[model samples]
Target: MKKRLTWAAAIAAAALSGCALAPGPSLDSKRMHDDLGAPTDTTVYDVKLITPQLIYALKQADEADAATKQASLSTQALPAESADYRVGPDDVLGIYVYDHPELTRGASGNAGNDMSPLVDIGTLQASGGLGGVLPQQISALGTNGQGEVDTSGQRVAANGTIFFPTLGRVHVDGMSTQQIAALLTRRLGSQIKNPQVDVRVMQFRSQRIQVTGDVKNPGQLSLTGSALRVVDAINRAGGGNPDADLQRVLVTRGNRVMTIDVNNILNRGDLRQNIALQSGDIVHVPDHTQNRVFVFGEVPKPQTVFMNQGRLSLADALAAAGSIDTMNANPRQVLVIRHPNPPLAQLDGTQGTVQEGLKKVSYAPEYNKPEVLRLDMTQVDSMMLATQFDMKPLDVVYVGTAPVSRFNRVLTEIMPTAQSMFMLWSIARNR
Candidate 1:
């Protein structure tokens, strides 16, 4: 036992002596970030000097935030009359002729040239439920002044005209139900006694919109009316796909194109982009490509933070990633890596090709070019710097750790092994 004790003491003494002789921890945060600033192929910009740009960006952001709030505050609904869905081709309409019961028969029975009793839509539906007779299918049973039995209800032709009994071919292409009824009433007043007509649109089949790209179901949709908003159309297409970029939905109508940030509408209650959709419009939700900023290094979460309202700043990115690890991180050594803006090429008399232009722009700098910015919060206010520095997509925010903190972390990891060795040495010496 005594021999074993002597060997253990010798081993413990040698281990302690080796640790004492070893070089001290040299993980200086400022020195480590020195290479981060003004390094090879990197252009360093001091945050203090760019106060003018920061002020402009922050002012714009504040104005935009206020505008978003103002939009949400407005409670006035869109004018109902302004959204009057104009009647179009393929629409099913229910026509009613006052005082003439025989003129209002369903499409089922043939237009009997005789004066037959008119069975109203309510009576027909009540007899055998909805399957009995639909209101929109109701048509005049008796013949017109020309003695022709028009059994088929009015179907707006491809040429935007509908064949009527006495009225012959009526052009109802952009006309409303009320306008059609008034026209029929005025024409039929001369033929019949005190003629009055009523028209109501039953089925809206004309306005078909196509929703594609990042939608659960990408296909054409028949809009019920002009009331179909952008949000409603997206929902009708089975909502957005899992990887859909809600912030950058493109809506195209011929030459006019607009991008809608649905995240602002859904999350921040901004409804300015929730505009009314038109016929032949295309709504496309694209895949989430460049919608996140990376905050790594000494942050608590060190995660890729997604943006709202399609805009993000350093302050928002840091807050989203749970801020920097204050216990072990140096707030003074914050670095943001960004892409450098390429200068415009000298335009010649001739138009240049896209590839040639790209090549010319490539001469400016690569995307990974170290356009690094060091944010020294120790000298200036931390909040001020964070708010001023606008973080673009794919920008990397890294917070480095202090040298003393790094040394402390190293010692914490080695302390357990050192303590065990010390205990063994104490036991051996006592023995």
Candidate 2:
């Protein structure tokens, strides 16, 4: 009876020890319970049943949306294209006469005295004594120091009012080159038979656009004519650096400011957001400090991923971090923590449902819908499925221990005792 009781006690102790030796739930599971309370299986599918913190984040995102709408409304009152652009003080103009050579003399007269019928009329490159002539002629005009040249080799006064031998002081400010040329032709018609005048920009010194931040090179870029688009300016700056946040490009012209998504143009091929640039405009490329997502847990290489273009999905993010640990990974518990903003919130909220709906709606795995994702790394066949899971920034992919790992640990602990007991029982039976 005593032997029976001892054996029973031994068995109970062994069973109790075995239970203790078994692996507990993962650290992430424990943390989830502690930080977010117990996660119910039902709540996993329903966003409404999520934690209050998540709901608060969602509300904050909604508030941001409202603010964005209000700001957009304010800009709606402003003209789509600015009309305040006037020929400002000290602004340079490029003058060209096309086929008419005599009317296209340089204001500085540095083109040499050969008096050729046709001039290349290149941009003004004043050197040595030639630079003084143009500025001096411009100062003589009664108007501001802005200068002009007429067909008769006459330099206009500072006020852009040049008195030709026939036509006296005509105001050329606030007028297009074509308009000014036509006016000159009309003025000179009576003096000279069938006079022709031509004008083109020579220098773009006054028409400047400031490009600052996150570019390979950042500084003031020249805008010659109306051809200097936003992309042209960025290209002039040597394009965005590796870490540039192409999503938010700010353009401020006077009191008006516009935010353009350059990434949309590059990535999605959306040309609508490509806006035309204007003079005295500031193109600020802010540092891409915010659009980063951290990948942790059981990924092979955990890191903070920089998002260059539009929204980054979950699977893309995971692949970027060298993929999850397939050897000891659990795909079902992949956690994606996104911004509380509406677009991201909406994306994350619909993820599970979309994935599930795909499997239900589409018979083929490849035809699966967007957002519904499952991670099963058990077989090599599931590799494609793993690849299909989209990843968002700041997403956490945890690959827990394989079942074999847990079983090995438990079996190793029990094997020594089991072997010793078998040996002792054999010795007693032999005796």
Candidate 3:
């Protein structure tokens, strides 16, 4: 009997080793939960469901804070009256002198003059000469008998001044063309008898604004009339592309950049984000590429969901993944793995105090440490909590399998092997 037992034990050990080394489909149960990597440096947090009133209050606070920030950054106030387009350096101005045709180069008399068509005012002034600058620009006004503009318009110099015949240097920066014409008329009064000066901005080359990224026609937009609002520039560029994220549309001014949610303005009637863009403002509508959240485990479709309109609630993400399995999913063990770091809230999305949310749920303060938060979907009001929970980029949502289902799975896997072993034992005994 001892020898028989020893032989059976030896055979069983050899069989187990052979199966371990076998190159074939694994007999082990295949499930997503099986590949859940070992947990390391994880802090678990439970869902905190607040009253509807509290949620409303929190939203109000966030909106107010956003409004205040928007107002402070919008340096130029919305114009009460139609704002005049101010001239800047490098703008081309068409100067016309009535009756005194000789004052302008375009006049028939000056056609043969030894002057280039476009005379740079700044260059002429630097050379300690005033005669050439005026003829170069004003000659266009006094055309030859054919009534054609011979000279190019006067270009505003870098120093915001334009040189006229006798009027050495006149500052025109930030002044309207009409304002410039009036000033020139007064200055040219002594030189030319009753000088009637007429200034017309031929080409608005100064206020060049860039509206790029995600627009159908992205390029430089010239700010011609009244101050161009953020929306006007967007419209001028043929609006945002289909995949453009209206939320978090960036407006870059000099060193500072501000993101505005156009969706909020359209849906929630939040007009604070519609800023009057100044010169040098670059409007960029980014493509909705990075807006995604991962969902795995017991869901019918464990996949990544793109955040629609720069926002995806917890419920939305779960729904996008086809929701948790009703039969075998642990509703209490829905895990959200997130890492706390950096400038807190995103530029435009569901606004929430990161510190407050993390602290309220007792999350780890260390940014490097990953936090494993448990959202109990079993509760009746859990959906409300999910609505308030906004999904961030790269957030992983995992639904755990029910304990009983796991046990049944294990049992199903072992029962076949157990039956085979019993059959082998009986065969050996019979032999």
Task: Write model 3 residue lDDT over 278-324, tens digit each, in one string.
Answer: 77889899887765788999999999888887788888999888889
lDDT scores of the candidates, listed in order: 0.66, 0.54, 0.70
Candidate 1 lDDT at 172 equals: 85
What lDDT, from 0 to 1, does candidate 2 have?
0.54
> Once superposed on the true structure, which residue ranges of model 1 sit more than 4 Å away at CA?
1-59, 62-81, 101-152, 295-305, 308-333, 337-374, 377-392, 398-431
TM-score of each model, paired residue for residue: 0.56, 0.51, 0.69
Which residue pairs show collisions in model 1?
A: 103-140
Q: Which portions of model 3 show Cα errors greater than 4 Å?
A: 6-10, 19-39, 42-46, 50-54, 75-84, 101-142, 149-151, 157-175, 311-315, 332-397, 412-431
Each prediction's RMSD to truth: 12.5, 13.3, 9.8
lDDT of 1 by residue, 1-431 (tens): 87877789687788788875679775647655455555484555544333546558757975675565335423322233344567788865556675563553222332232223223435765564233234443333333534443344566778898776677888888987789889888888888977767665555677778999988988987766447778888998899977788876777766545567688788877776687777898999887666678898888898888765467888899888888887878877788876543212222324443222112223322343445667766765667867767776567788889899999999999999989878887777766
Instruction: Give candidate 3's whole-model lDDT.
Output: 0.70
Best by lDDT: 3
Model 1 lDDT, residue 187, Cα = 85
Worst ten in a row by lDDT for model 1: 353-362
Best by TM-score: 3
